[model samples]
Target: MALVFRPDKKSIEKTLAALKSYGNLVAPDARFNYDAKDGLRKEVCFRDEDFLSLLSSIDDEYVVDSILEMLKGKALVPPDAFYSKDAFDKLVALTKEKWYYPWTSFTKAMRRLFYMLASIKQPRIVVGMGIFYGYTLAWSAGPSCGKDKLYNAERVYGVDINTEAIEGARKNFAILEGSDHVELIAEDGRLVAQRLEGPVVFLHLDADGEKIGKKLYLELLKILYPKLAKGAWVLAHDVTDPGFQKQGVFTEYLNYVRDPKYFSESILFDIDQCGLELSIK
Candidate 1:
């Protein structure tokens, strides 16, 4: 249930030949990359362009469209689904206007992917773990709880370990157009998830742990595994391919999602070095 994006092949061609070609690329026997975070955190080689080199060698919109096509093929979204350009622009601009934090790691493609998943899935309850400034929360919650909401959401909760960051994110979310359903909680992600009763429609993970960092994803997933409703979507940020990932952090996490015993299917959006993984329950 995993996918791969190849630079030589241009896009993820989902044909039989393409899948066969990507076999070696995604083989489990591949060596792990410990410094996978280095390339992601480094600056642009060229001065004036995107500091993160958001689109280093590929077209941004094209990558998004290709991923959407893959999702459509999997029947996760409509045949002709497309996230609105104006809506996405407004969401980004508004968040930038009121943002209190100095950093948000999500690049443009990653942000769009989160928004697309939310809008398409139309999840009723969206939970974000390790939400720093609610930037990730806003992207996923935009379609249902923000100023540019396409539909209303019942509840959207953001859990963060940093009390001061949560306070800043609270102020940022306070300015959303129709974000009454959104709440920022200053608590550990696992604890907040443990408190959830049931039927959490959507979950976003981007937390950093003291020892494991992103590996806490597996623990959070196990906690909410029973509460997730049918067709629920779980997104883990930074679940990139082997070379662009930290060692030992996501091995068990990815295995859980790829297992049919848990998620029905999982796809890795490797458009960015800092990738996103989507799993359906």
Candidate 2:
């Protein structure tokens, strides 16, 4: 497809520079083509715009790449950057109430990362599918900030394979001292496909590999498409390009989702080694 934005003499260089930034996008080698001839070269990356058009288009990939590029060359900050003293106090209070955060790593790293990202976007509801004792991130973000918020909807509502994890998440939520609106549930995220609702934001921490990720990804789209308000995003974890040392499930799903006709955009991130921040249009 022709890029949405055409290049002129004044903008050709700028457009080329933007394409160069996506040099690391992973795909079948044949997906992109490059040639050098007569002291001239051309590189075709993913189907994107003439760099100038990207500045104006709302393509999901465009937004994701822009955000990732903005994040690059920048150091991550502590949770304090996003959480206020009161919010922190509430989180700690809830944790203490329920004997939560027994693990220092969750408090120090996971929760901190969640809050920092949340502070930037501040979605009303951040849902984590198939949560296994990992609600601290959502709790630390505080309640009443969003229209809908839940942790481990499947586990909370009594879904199978999540009983153990749900028990732990419940204890963690208890520590928050009855900030009960976080809406812990125990229903399968797959079931979400038929239950259309309002604009919802989600975080899929559910561990899935190639086939599983693909299944979950499609199921999630079925459930969330009609429900999502314009501009909603999904943050999926564990996606990476580890030099293709082995058959990686996360890598496969990342590739599948980046298809422009399906999921429009993605932002590669190095959170805990590797991850992709996705924005579905």
Candidate 3:
């Protein structure tokens, strides 16, 4: 990730030290405008070439267009990549409700991408970390209609640390049509990951992005690595958010996935700061 901060030697040194603690190497890059006080601010690039390449590869023109159409023109055209009618219908229905938390609702473009990928992957088990009102859980569950169902996944498991949020999600699930396939658990994500036994075909990470977030994410990865099925798809939220980027969350995450052992193909959907990684194990 690219970072531009005020040209303070002490601040730069502190930032570099923090980044190195997360297994990142700092490299000097071209300066850019950061604020009015600083005419031109210094820039630094994290040495995560593989992760950056993966982010570039998955950013498609069609995805960008779809995001613009949804947010700008308020158009709801499903991307051509999403061919499942049932999945599309579910996405539309979920968006109509105001059940999700204001901060946690999935954007239309992100939902569309998830529907498309889930339809294609047809994972046997769908796992969601940090469930907030179950909006993403519904999407990961895929279409519930027997005739319209195209995925092989039988159930979706949602884990969240907040008991109140878990209760809210359960209430939302109760009112949702064809939501019988969802299971909500109020527990730490790390424990949930440890208990999960079967192959995970689809995984979504949407938890916090600081110390707790980094710990839970990495711990879950260690547990899930052996359990991931071939063609498993993983989506991580907020990788490009300004707050996360400032906190070095994105850099630490990129370093983890950049290892050759984890994923075969990975991409960062620039829209809504969603990052996706694919594994063929």
Candidate 4:
């Protein structure tokens, strides 16, 4: 019966105790806070907005990791302050693919994707190839496993082809609990590489077409190769969607499938029988 996004630990504890009085808190922290004023000086506060603002200050790479822990239902515990890269990756993947609950499942997918990227060595940047309303909304939810972790990403960017989608993404982040961790760009996803100035920890090509997705992926590799961290994570969503197959998007873009340079890795999920993960290792 815990509330949502409790910023400060002390306040969160008090809130949790109070929420237990209610019928298994589903969203008590929906709007809770803790503030103290001394003379003419006001100190810290613990509101959902404040919690989100705190998340905004986080580094992009770590943000995903932090949120993964939070959604796992671990961040609520008193902190012993531990950070393990391997532990993080395993935990993230487990939480996402293993956790229950419809909303929590979405958060887990995002966490799995984000943690995979964050774990890459010395990544300098991360990008969301395209932002759509449903996708962004799905990405914004917290972790489904650990609770102690908080967001800590370094540099992040979100790109999109639709202006309205971009705007919706912006508004979504504006109201979400921890949106300050990302940057949103309402532009064509194909040009993300040209626009970015650093190595990529992760890249997601979620545009609605195979041609554009392929072009963007190749362009990103060409422009950002030097900056690409070894073993970095790259994600392509809806790669096997009916529309893509119907239009032969994958066949058109992958006409000459490259060898060893890239390989496919699949992620199995119980939610969707068609769910398959594609990656190069």
- Candidate number achieving the greatest lDDT relative to the actual structure: 1
Error of 2 at 113 (Å): 2.6
lDDT by residue (99-213, candidate 2, tens digit) is 6433422323334445545555455555665555655444334533332332222211212135566677666555554345555555566664356355665444443323564
Q: Give lDDT: candidate 2, residue 58.
A: 31
Give all TM-scores, in the order shown. Answer: 0.78, 0.53, 0.67, 0.47
Error of 1 at 5 (Å): 39
Clashes of each: 1, 16, 0, 28
Give one digit per residue, the lDDT tens place, for model 1 in 179-261.
88898899988898888877998999888887777788899999998999998999998876344252556878989899998
RMSD (Å) of each candidate, 1 decimal: 11.1, 14.7, 9.1, 18.9
| lDDT of model 1, residue 179 | 86
Candidate 1: worst-modelled 10 consecutive residues by lDDT: 43-52
- What does candidate 4's lDDT look like per residue over 1-281, in tens digits? 98776257777777676765653222544433335442232433332334333443443345545544553463322244333455555454543454322231123334444443343322345676655642432232222112423444566677777777777666655543344556777766546667676656565555553455444555554565555565554555544443444455555334322334553332322112112233443
Model 4 bad stretches (over 4 Å): 1-124, 137-151, 209-222, 252-258, 262-276
Each prediction's whole-model lDDT (CA): 0.78, 0.46, 0.63, 0.46
Better of 2 and 3 by lDDT: 3
Report the CA-based lDDT of candidate 1 relative to the real structure. Answer: 0.78
TM-score of 3: 0.67
| Residue runs of model 2 more than 4 Å from their true location after superposition | 1-110, 136-161, 207-215, 241-245, 262-264, 274-276
